[model samples]
Target chain A: MSEVNNKKLRTKDLIYAGAFGALYIVLMLILVMSSGMVPILYILAPITVGVFCGTVYELCVLKVRKFGPALIMGLLFALVACNGAWYCFVTATACALLAELIIFLGKYKSKFMYLLSFVVFNINMSCPYMIMTFNRDGFMTRARDYYGEEYANGLSKLMTPWIWYALVGFAIIGGILGALIASKLIKKHFTKAGIV
Target chain B: MDFDICVDDSGAILKLDPRTKLVMFLTSSVASLTCYSMENLLIYGIVLCVITILCGKKWLGVKSLLIFLFLIFFRYEIVTSGKGSAAIGGLLTSLITIFLFFFPVFMSLMLITQTTRINQFLAAFDAMHMPNIVVIPIAVMFRFIPTVAQEWDGIRKAMAFRGISLEPWAIIRSPLKTIEYILIPLLFSSISIMEELAAAALARGLDSGNNRTSYETVKFRAVDYLVTFMFIGLAAFFIIGRKGL
Candidate 1:
């Protein structure tokens, strides 16, 4: 079983972590920057970001086949991007550490455990957006003052309090979709190519 | 703009020790985030542009300068023009505020990445006696980014050869296919590259347990101190002003 043969992280694993982490950041940055210009894409950003993250997570896990990659990846991304408040690093690290534990607990053999880790890892995708939660009142007030009472009210109505909570749901769906896609690609191309 | 760290030994700014560069980057990033005033942001933005241009990144410097000018222009227009429609005005103002707050920090980050080479940065970290756990991951990360870019370029060329429309519109039209064709190959290639990179790093004794020596000189000179003090002063001024001192 792959579980029995599991080894500790190596220098290569660290490199893989760094590479995949950079990939995740670059992907999200591209999407976020573009979404900023076309605000309509904002709605879809969280889920799609999650999807991209999940894909990277899956690949990282397969290649590294060890623990701590997620944590390092998340931490490096946070430090470089300063993607959010201090809490972002905390949450991202915690999520990745938890994923590492899950992969470890599953003895490195359970596909279910791996997929669960992907879901948790991808949740870090929501860290930047979480900034909105901290300044919700300020955001609303600014919207009201600048946009008009009607527009602000409409925005508030459209953005339910549970929007961030719903983002978690979107994260889960995205994670699943990304994992399924990665799974297919790995099976079809990578496994045969011996890359995996 | 190119975000990767530049290795060219051209600019006076580029000649500063990587440790100094790192300190400057950290200082600017923290200050950019902490200082909320638009005036401070503009000052920080201009200083950042000068540094970027001095570091031989003229194109990025100009691009960043233009962005800063646009932000200033946009704010001026909004403030001077009799209030426009509420939605448009609010949106514009909010965007301006966000841009003001973030652009400096972004520029600072870009400056560090664009000017300091990865090996030099990591060597400086080692010289500073940073924990191996932290240093190793960061070094790996720096190496990883460029490898991914190279692999991505290869994938793009392959797509072009295969008659896949590499345009934004085509990708937008069929994202899933793009992901399937482009990202999948990229991922597979990156997996192998990751392994090779790891092997190369291991061969260089990157994961060694002993104290390591670097040939790169990483000393803080007067300019480093001056830059550091300037940033500290800016932060202090912002905090004092915020406190109504």
Candidate 2:
């Protein structure tokens, strides 16, 4: 565990961030496809990011060995996935910035800090669901206008406040699972391959 | 599975500068997110679809348009229909709606990715006087995405050889094994690729403070301005519509 590298990011750092960022994006695309068919699956989507954050952050530490890759990757992801609502960029950037801070505080060496960084990074994964939930009023109105008042209200009640809490709760659990899995994978594969 | 990198360089969007296309993407994406009304989003969808068709992506254009229409109609049905099947129908409809809302942004990004060449994009960024730190990563990213796809194919084949199915159910069933088998290899290979890419970029003096020149000629045409204004006006119209002012 070294203190966060204060030197400027080199070309290698950018390359690491960009390449890993692409991997993250592609993995996210797969998760999105798997989850897209059912609304119930969408709530679980954020957890996927948490699941992979361990591997990604570990790779980041090993390769770039510097600060800001998380932030850069976050910005790149938002730019590529700009199809989401505008606030996505805001949230993505914020999450990355927070992850960067976490990594900094942990000096990029503490295993716990690495896990915590991922937990914060998981916040970006929650963006789409957040957008959907927050804009429920608009969606609800459209539903009511079409289905008649009774059905829309029933649909609304079905989506209780607990669903939102459940989303965050799942994300935190996913983060823990991801960190655990990543550590195992790092020990097994990354170490064998000399990647970490 | 192919990303939107230019092949024959024949699309209508390819004629516009990459920077201009980037602006169009940003505007349309923002407008789609900002405008809450379905009708406004529909208009944006139509505009994007028309552009896609004109760019010779006829099938993509048509498919997206159909999805858009289906979403609108289905959303109405989900609300008005009684509760017998409302849960399932409502679930799918809402899922599609979220995607539909971001349709224009995705379409525009597709146009850029499919039509613009990597060097052209880099040239455009260089012309904009972006720093090397930003430019190098983005350049690497453009190259990395396609390579990752290639690696993904290799991993899939190996998995198949070992009798591992990549279908969603298979993944959901044995998540840990899947990550160990599929994700580990993907990450492992990607790391090497990243190292090589970084070396290659540095070898090309990408980190130099000096100005880099390119063979690609990137210029803004009249159509670029026209498209830009059109999107700007569309955004203004949506904002005005939203405010009722």
Candidate 3:
């Protein structure tokens, strides 16, 4: 019932992915239903989805399956999330992909992947928000256009300095924390948890 | 008969088909957005509240939406004080508009979903040029959230036994570290899960067209026609009303 390394995917493995995709869509509807209150919920959602589902698929498909399939699934999910205006979807997907690559690249046994994945994640965090606000008639343009000179005059009003940097820094660190937790847990219980 | 509010489980609108409820929702939103007159908006507001009561979803969800609109109006006031009375009026109008605008769109969404099964909803989209590639994957993704949440809870408890407090901020300060150490396994699990799902679907004999079964069946009842006509009638009144024509 076990193999050192297998490559051929069982039919059930594909169905598992499909099921997860449907699950993702339904969760998205739930998100829309509760958009305002649960902004941070979805930010952490992709990591869990990627880890559990991708790990299970890899297990069923190949005892020693690499991260390639999971990476592709992530890339697809990101593209769809982007089109769907689920702003953080792409960033989340990128984070997952980067982590997988790092782990596999580091030979799945290095603490270095942990650090590398974290570093890569910081640059990735700014991407989606930038893409979000940089479009025509978008928030950045709107803010600049409507606020005009007052925006540049250092706002004769109160503001949070370093808030933006804090957001990026914290979120990326949060993502790394998530990855670290997964790696540790999976290494310990990958077998008994049936995670392959 | 027209839709009526029922008070059983959670005090929601009952006896309305998904499609009909959806239409009403959209209509409400559009009407709210289209009308700027405070008087008109107030009238529409009453009508919406009544409908919400009728539909039985008199939850905080609807109430919160209105509150959100009010917040916007309040913010607008702070911003529009110098823009004149008309600006104030416009800002309020915009708030009202946004609140109501969701009505028609979400009503249809709620209607279809409420009256029909999930797969049926998927089928409707599928019939309407929704690519399987898109629909199928999205469905899977949607279902993954709860499962992951459950797993995370388990992991948190297990970690707690080893004296690890799963507080998000307490873990580390850098976002990069979190990504590397925590989330990669998530994406990895997602891809791995798919393999099992694909196999399961094959076992179940789900091909392109194998009579996708569903639980809910809906048709245009007499009352449905009546409701549709009522919408048209109201729309007509708006179009032909004073200042409209």
Compare the candidates by TM-score and give the number of the best one: 1
Candidate numbers sorted by DockQ from highest down: 2, 1, 3
Q: Write the per-residue lDDT of candidate 2 for residues A1-196, one digit (tens) a residue.
A: 1234456787667778888887888788767765654444655677776786568766775556578888888888788664446665687688889988888787666777876777777766766555547666655665454334454566566566446556677777877788788778888877776665
Q: Relative to the unseen true structure, what is the C-alpha lDDT of residue B127 in candidate 1, on a scale of 0 to 100?
A: 78
Candidate 1 C-alpha error for residue A159, in Å? 3.9
Which residue pairs collide, candidate 1?
A: none
Q: CAPRI verdict on model 3?
A: incorrect
lDDT of each: 0.69, 0.71, 0.44
lDDT of 1 by residue, A107-172 (tens): 777878887888777776666555456656645664554334554666677567666676667767
* Per-prediction DockQ: 0.41, 0.41, 0.16
Candidate 3 regions with alpha-carbon error over 4 angstroms: A1-15, A18-81, A84-127, A132-137, A143-181, B1-61, B77-116, B125-133, B143-209, B215-245
User: Residue-wise lDDT of candidate 2 within B56-99, one digit each (tens)?
Assistant: 67777778788778888777666567556656765555566657
TM-score of 3: 0.44
What is the C-alpha interface RMSD of model 3?
9.3
lDDT of 1 by residue, B1-245 (tens): 44353456565444666655566666565665456556777787787788778777788898889988897888767766857786677667655665665576667666666667767777888777887667777766655565566677778788889899878899789877878787777777776676777677678888887876776777777877777677668767765664457
- Candidate 1 wrong stretches, greater than 4 Å: A1-6, A81-83, A138-158, B3-6, B23-37, B56-59, B82-102, B146-154, B166-169, B232-245
Worst 10 residues of 3 chain A by lDDT: A150-159
